[model samples]
Target: MSEEIGRVGGPKNVREALLISSETADRNRHEIYEFGPFRLEPAERKLSRGDEVVTLTPKVFDMLVMLVRHSGHLLEKDDLIRSLWPDSFVEEGNLSNNIFVLRKALGNDREYIETVPRRGYRFVGAVRQLPPTGRNAISGVLEGQIRDVPSRQTRRGWKILFAAAAALLLFAAVFILRRFRGENSASSPNSPHLAVEQRLTSNPSDVPVRAAAISADGKYLAYADPTGLYLSQISSGETRRWSLPKDFVVFPRSWYPDGAHLLVVRDPKHPLDSSLPNPSLYKLSILGGEPQKIMSNAWGGSVSPDGSRIAYLSHTNAGDLWIMDSDGANARKVVAGPDPNKGGAGQDLIWRVVWSPTGQHLAYIQAHYRNAPDPVEPISSLRIVDPDGGGASVVLEDARLGPVALWWGREDRILFSYREDPANAQRNYGVYSIRIDGRTGKAIGPPQAVTRAEGFIEGMNGTPDGKRLVLWRLRVPAQVFISDYDPGTRQWKEPRRLVLDANENLAWVWTADSKAVFFVSNRNGTWKLFKQAIDETSPEVLVEGPSISDPRLSADGTQVLYLSSSNPDDASFPAEVMSKPIAGGTPRVVIQGKGIGNFQCAMAPSTLCLFSRDGGDYVFRVFDLEHGAGRELLKLQHQVWSENGSWSLSSDGSKLAIFLDQHRIRFFSIATGAAQDVTVKDWPLQNGDWGANSQTVFMPSHSPAGVPVILEVDQTGKAKVVLQGKPNADFGWMIQSPDSRHAVLGEYIPTDNNAWILNDF
Candidate 1:
């Protein structure tokens, strides 16, 4: 079974590696097939209905042959794509277009091609395989039937013999053509194009997939999980843990030409840590033992085509490109991040550096975000350059380009992940490919999507044989649940899901009257704001069309406020902070700004609204309910990560609680400009928010076991666990009503990735 085309050596080897599909190969009985009024000739590559030849395009003809060959059986779309386009992958739309054209040519009166919905297409018509008409069959049938030989034995014998000789010659020619060109044979179900996908592991979110790589021979798979690094037999699914020195976390990155050793990434920090430091590159033997350190603080050292040198990234982001020997010796900088003077956007983020198939050029993705701190409006460019630091040029560049990773595949092709649908990129991330001219090292045409599915294809590695692909899809599946706070018991009631649907959901704050909760969900594909009443089972859609998030009530409690944009990840879109009257009215823009990180508002009569934007550093802005624009409040010069520098407005609109660090919190008085610092006991806090009374703060952190925990910090620096979520769940945010009668908690769901082996993809 062929799987990965990206792993193959060259186009010459690719063409020879793929042959007549098994399904059609074994059925090539040197015969003609017939169905209804149509007669199909395999060796002739022609279809005729009562002598009327049905003209068909080459690709369309190929599609019809496969469907007719596997009549009544579903031909998977992936398999068909592989068969039709053996070298380059295209979007499913291309396959649909071919099918539509084929149907039209086949006279669509009867449902010849049946689409199985999300699956593949099937040919429902009955088919008959007619035996080959040879010289022997013709002589045998007619020789006995013709009793009267026109009263001349010599003439009759000569005619029969001549006919037999011509039939024999024709049969021999047909047999030879079928062997070389595959005639009308379609790819068999077992062909690489139709390779079946197999899941190798069923691990949960806690033991997420670290990394995976397929061997060149397509016989073994090297991967890393929470347990440890493992080597698995592809055919038997027999996986064995590799015994190595403990303490450091490790993940398999790529394979060496020898296949006995693998390039691995070793991180000294704990794998379960929320934030991990940079990892060092290492070379580990599959035979087991200690891994040898290759280079420190580097990435991408996969074996070059000739197994001489490697191109690696000096840093993870905005890093210089460097090439080093195979044994980690004689390392030197080959290329640095894009220059700022040459119309370059600051430092170019170098991602997924790979050596071209022939070791002629090095391919890499240069990317930059409009807002660096928060990574908004990502502009990615696929560029390649000579390893000697010459012949540098951009192959493809797009403002909305966000590929999971890029890989130079077989046949001078590069495979990368990108979203097809711009509106809802969350579920549309798929693998795409583009062919490169071997001589010029330039793209031949626009990129085409090869694989499309839900979740993110975080990692992909194909076998060198171009027959198998290793897929690692990552997903963070979460749902919203309401946990009521009981002042009587000073505890939270058992949480009940806010929305019954299975889609991911998150709640920010309750409605003005506290009778309902406004939350964001991707139930209809894109993230939208919806209000769910506690008394009702269904939620009402409050905002749709544009992507919206962070649903909160205005400080005066008379309006609903949310951040809406065309593309959430893109900071250039300029998110509009909109508000609508709770009693029902068109939403009006309060303020719009590019690179808005997040926004929040205090309870009724407080009029304390704050929004943060991340261009390079974090900047805070404040606005009132009646104001159309906001005034800059505070500008943070220091870089803020996911957790550090978290802030929240107080319910009384008198102060702001901000996390100066993991263990420190600062409360700034709004009017007097007074500040008070308080220290907490939590070792690491993601963020902190002000409570209803404005005197206490809640800090969110995760336990080592991956459970979400919230810490309640008092003015005296004392802390206690207020709310802890279930296992494999995240604590999104915490919100309390102004009355303090009840509280709403956002519990994030488990997130995990699956390792799959797709044959012949």
Candidate 2:
């Protein structure tokens, strides 16, 4: 109902309201009723969701009012079609699709409009009806009326109403909190943490060793520490702390889909500690129980959809056909035996394991064969296997395709990420999908590419309905966006910016309306609550937002919530946790931990807040930023020394990708308590970019003896030289362009003592 100013000014005055109503009165076809929380000037056609301007296609807005005015009646399919498309011939399906799309853009308030079975649609919510007031009540209000309005309510009555409103708000908060927890199914089988860190200066924080994972029920999240594990409650502010034995180093690897336990990799000594001893995987628990050893050879691990089994790649010498149930008593090899070509070695070097949504098959990575550590190893291919462990084969492989990501869905279909390089081999990766059991394990091509430039995919969690695919893309400095994955069309819609600001780090939640995005941003210098209309041509900022990151939208999209800092100005550190409205209003702080930097926050599928506590030690703590009850999952002895580690959470929140020191990277499984080094030997210099899918890392590598070239690495652990020319090329200073279409090569021209942008190779 709020009106947007063309530029910037105060609220709309009485004269303007009168002018608007009078102008629309002549064409008042059916007494058009337009009103919301504050006020709106329909005739001006300018709408505001608080202080931000909401841009909308003219038609989308028109459709909105038509439904609003008809507040409580069903508008049959044909009935509305006739009114809207009177002059044109359109199909019923088209009308239905348009209505559906419009609803998505309008956001959660669509509750006012109800879907009426096979009949049509109805607007059932209350409408703030505006009256003509013959004498113009707003502008032409008499002095007596103004006096009477205030006199009607005494100071005490006003106080009572304010108190009642506050109480009701509190009750509503409780209801919504319970609803989200209950609906998301505290035990839903998916929990992926979205990690966002901004490298503000020339020097970035040591690549963060942050780890994230979700409980089998999607409620609990386990994160890594240099020394231990931290268990956090996703919905309620709750947490439990776990410390690894002093002698045995532990790191989380995977979370059982069952949500009750975890699988961790425990090493008597660090595997990278001496770079000789092999790492092993062990199963851990969150409900407080003894850990059981799973595999001595397992590294990058994954749990099956049924939760009865596990899969992981053994050491290079061990066969890689994907050992299943590698945890339980019935554990055995699942995929076919290793490839015979390489002396009957492993069949795949599994990076990401996507269990079929319907629980039929699995898709994983098959690293390429290499005799030496040349930076030109291509991706082997994608391998699909059944749970029973036998019908396994390469589903996609080509000279151009590189192993990126593999995600399984209902019909044994696999959604993967790869790059298409016709020749030079500097192929940039993008999102794609394919059926595992198709004809030959050849290139069937991806349905849609998620990113154009070398963008990294942070989180890709499918919606409960399986219609929407939520993803996070990171460039430099950082930007958060949302894209709609429509399986029916097999096309990925262009991604829309979720958070308005581009320079800051952002994490968000999507409501029912694809456009109404609620996210947390550092636009205010510190993280804060911010909401915008994803559908609106121009989104309006709902609230100033709290200093929080990792925001999750309720499944229905009605609420925009997130964890807030326990305190805004502790001076010691960030606030604990808090939440507020996506539509912009007051915020409620939920958790207040002493000496905690509330700024450390990550949001997985579960709505819990994952934050870091940096002080005496680098601590990863999880709590329902809203309810304030959770514990620590793990802590690392090296956590304190590590500064800028980029932490990433797996979709299921079972695995965490921690990039410590731009060159050293590791993946810790929350389930296995195992931390495996993903760092490639001599991985160029420091600070480059995270390739598409997040798994593929792109960093400028110097060919010590040859030309200085930029190398690209895939999830398969294979690397390829992407660019080369000048010796000692400003590698660390090189940056990706805004459009990502071109990379800026910052070079200091010795002749002129000036820097030039290399537009030409």
Candidate 3:
């Protein structure tokens, strides 16, 4: 039977029969059956409830079959359209008309099928077969009835039957017209809370990380959504706004110094136009005004405390830091000739200038790409420099740390962290703080650490005019807290929990007013941006849309920009970043069509590679939530390949390490197009990522014993075993926390249905 089933390319007859019921002739039943308030007899090609006949067309009958067979599953509108008219093209309105007819046949019980917003309909109802009389008795009765009908028609009964038929037709004609009008009214464009939903795996939400950053005052939030940036208000969920121009691909990177404006980055013009510079930084006002371009050739930058100067990393292969005026003038080189002799020409790239709280000094991480002729790790370091390009020094040099993340306090102190390696082939970042200027450098807590674990440290304003400190801690479900400092004790107090169960992560930017946190959450399974008090219940959906990501609230919380997936039903989940108002209105698509399909995001938001317009090619696209467009940057022609293409990135977005050429692992630098081979022994390299510092890359190697091992290496071509063993440990998709303080591994126990996270060890 199994062989027969396989040969026939379908399930066995026994299984098929079991799926249905007995008594009904196998040949009499159609491919699909619908039995509910309305009994549709496909062989008779009629629909009826009890003795009352209901009129329907052949196409509508077929639609009923499709909906019933897959009852309780959301059926995409496109799928239904194809199923009904496989050989012929039909207008969308035709499908709608047929649905109206079907619903009329069902009468007031049309709720059996639910309409999901923006997608399709789902048949949700109870279905059961009718009890049968004795088989022979039923068959004999049906046969006699069939014979009687023919004989009666010959006995001059035509006149009476014709009169009845006329009345039935008249009733049906009026009923159908009314039903059509009713359906149109119900599906009005102005319907509130309407959303298209489908129970399909290939839909949106496949991407794991969806987050946004809110500023100190919490008045605005900045998000890097697949959609465009959005601004929502806390006082009254009344208005929502968008942030973007009509054509440019402008995504929100970070918030401005005052939260009164957003830091928007414009993506490269096009991949073919290599002359087009990388995304430049600009300041977009929350209240809406002309966007002031600050830097034209910078990838990532930050606003100085006074909001007068912008510190950014140049996108050129030379990789230098430059300080520019907020209005896009008076640019000065902050870091000159980083290994000038090397000419900054390699896969390894340095990053942005971070100004100290006092704005007196600047800091950045420098990369020294180690050419791994074989399986070797590269080395990198944290280099501090003056904003005027003076007094340069290397604060920390380590191959494993990757790119450094620096957090500045109001007291002119800089907090930096390093990770031992990328965790679990995914990313398990850890957290630790070191005082800049080579003073009081120590691991904050749980100092007895063998490896770095995942943690986060964000600047939260303290009481008494920003004299105190508030920091945020994030794992899978992120939370916030206030970090109390004791100068005499030289330690941070146990933090106070601010908000719990953040759903996903922050998706909106903080407002300059410091009163609320705006973000998007799918707690209800639909991505919508919201804003709430810092300690209030989580935010609510600010706008109505399908699959929104990368939401950045304008500094004043008046506008929002985000990338929204319009057609989640598409296999590729084709999306266009859109912009709307905080007050909520029609959203305009800023970035039109480009990518061929959806690419799973394995890297952090820093460096993302989506499917390019050209098949088999990938382009670095910055999803501008503010601008509602994804602009292409660097284009690569098949440099890396993956069946699933699951890979990871450096914290600073400089490098990408993925399984290349199938079994062997490879590392590719985003800046220099440098590719190298990594030494992967007995275990095949499945998934991995670069350390926080970007120099070292970690790949998961599973031994013959079925134990997963983390292979670690240094630039000197030295290799060593870091963490190995544990056949049951599924760390293939873990990630190192941003601060490099902790690593989270995916632990799945098949026996007990246990699949959960293991935090910092």
Candidate 4:
């Protein structure tokens, strides 16, 4: 899994790469360094070990001086790349080659150059700075040491240029360190009662903090807002906006061990689900510069404690855990997933892959759906594994434990967010901790609750010192809405919000008379079926459950339909189709199975309801309303690592359109036993439904970056954009009422997220 900026072959040695980097160094070359037996002269661009002179290329000479200058501190691989080839894009192999040559030139002193695994090379031998000589009292460094192309001929201006370069290293270095540590003072030791909570940002509801991370020293905060990316001084509250490229979508994930750079992710449309468009992982300086690309299609990149490697999840690979050198080289799979060779049964997700405090193990959540498309949440376990992929063990396993967020602090203690109440309050998610015995990698005691909140803590990050923590909280709730629609003209207007509350409400099936709407609402703390009339305000509870979802109507429109997982406390409960008369009564089990997916029904005159199961393939069967099961109608090969396809049933029960591939739809005729292919030409297709006329299909889609649009496509594959949606919101499901005058759409309203600091962790 080694990701390189460029994989092309490089010159055999540094001198053969056609790189000349010492223009500024040639003028400001005043510093001389000595380490072990090797002595380096910047003014003369020379190196020697005792009586023997070391032959070095220009770039190799530059690299040696850099390592000696920052002897004890880390020089990130990206930093070295920019310094070595500031104006050009070169394969990472060139840098590796330079180091290899330099190490060989240094001879028997194997201890001189220490490779930091994933990070970069470090000069481990004791280094001393020699007195300034040659009439030059000051030296400077730009991206390590000022660079210029190599020169085969001698410079006539060497004497004058060497003394002309002004001072920068001593003064700029001190000023930068002070500014980075703004009013940063050591706080009293961390204690439970002394825990202090502070709000770092005061943004409005619409303008939210996208993502954030604290500096290694706990003095600076880097965050992204609607306006732009910014860095804020914690103690002084002074914030400055980073000059990012227009329309850049970057979120700071964590800081490097050096405390001068941050690793960030770009175009992360869906952070939790890694099956979407590719996202980028890169590094950028807090002092401001162009981002240096590291890896593509990577997410949740959390650096190890030593900053030598990064643990990230692959996007298209669906939660395959991987670790790569901090330099984006020598990547290895840390955890074996669904064999990439087979890659098709179903994907088990891995997320929040953070390193343990000691850097020996990685803590993450393993989410698996025994029934991959069960509609219910997946079973999640808080687990850890050694960096070498050994000593794997689970710390916490429960039906209530989900994948909201996770973190590791001091003393082998892991803090995570879990659902506290079964069906009482989803918003009451609380933070809990399970202590692991460091030696055995197993839980030491029962889990303990750290804190409870009225809103969900979407994410968590801790300072390097382990004395502070930062949380990103989300409180936005979902609601059902209706809009007047004229499908012929493709116009939507006079929107009306229904069942308004602080809980989530998802639009589903309508009633027999089309006068009321039947939907799923979390108003009572758990998802249950509710029926509300178009003219009424209050909703009447129809199906009370420990939990239920994917509500629909019977073929005859006489019974309400839904799926219930049977047991609330069991993670392996199989979902069963439960039905009750439209007027309401005791629910009866109609069908029982696992891995049930999207299903739909037609009205009275047509008794066609289709049910599907996703596993080895997409199996669609003609289901009876009154009976338990029916015969299989069709099955299609499931595309691995791709979004599951969606289908819509025509009101007349004559046509069924299934959407799965990027551009084609399979339309099946129930009466003729004939199927035709309809292709969408506007853009890659997304979730949609059968149009009222059965001659058109309406699709709600968003761009790779999340700009919403509605498209109307016809049988011939011709299409046109009907309308565009709001900028900040995303669509869930769209359905039209039986009467066709109103349409119901599910929209996840934007949330106001801010960074909160907890001191004395």
Question: Scored by CA lDDT, what does every candidate get?
Answer: 0.68, 0.46, 0.48, 0.70
Question: How displaced is residue 1 in candidate 3, in Å?
Answer: 70
Rank list by lDDT: 4, 1, 3, 2
**Top model by lDDT, which number?**
4
TM-score of candidate 3 relative to the true fold? 0.34
Tell me the tens digit of each residue's lDDT in model 3 across 432-466: 34444333322233211222333322111221123
Full-model lDDT, candidate 2? 0.46
Candidate 1 lDDT by residue in tens digits, 1-761: 11111111111221221224323432443546677689776546788999699998877876776666555445667767887887796999999999889878777654567565466876766677665456422434456657865557877897899898767656654443333222234635332222233466557777778678887777888888767788988766688888887656687777887878888878644322425556778888877777898888886556676668867776433348888898889988878775533433333667677777677788887766453222134577888888888988778887545544767778578877776676662454667778888667678988775655556676777765556778787776557666678878898777777688656676767776777888877765767778888667798887775477767778778788887776666545688888988789898888888877677887756677888876656777887667655777776654332333357887788887777655677677778877788766534565767787888877666664445677777777788878887654567667765666556676655465768766656
* Residue 43 displacement (Å), model 3: 58
Clash count of each predicted structure:
13, 102, 86, 8
Compute each candidate's TM-score over C-alphas: 0.70, 0.36, 0.34, 0.70
Give the least accurate 10-residue stretch of model 3, judged by summed lDDT. Answer: 1-10
lDDT of 4 at 10: 27
- Candidate 1: what lDDT? 0.68
Off by over 4 Å in 2: 1-204, 207-211, 225-228, 235-241, 247-251, 267-277, 316-319, 326-331, 335-348, 369-377, 387-389, 398-404, 419-432, 435-445, 449-761
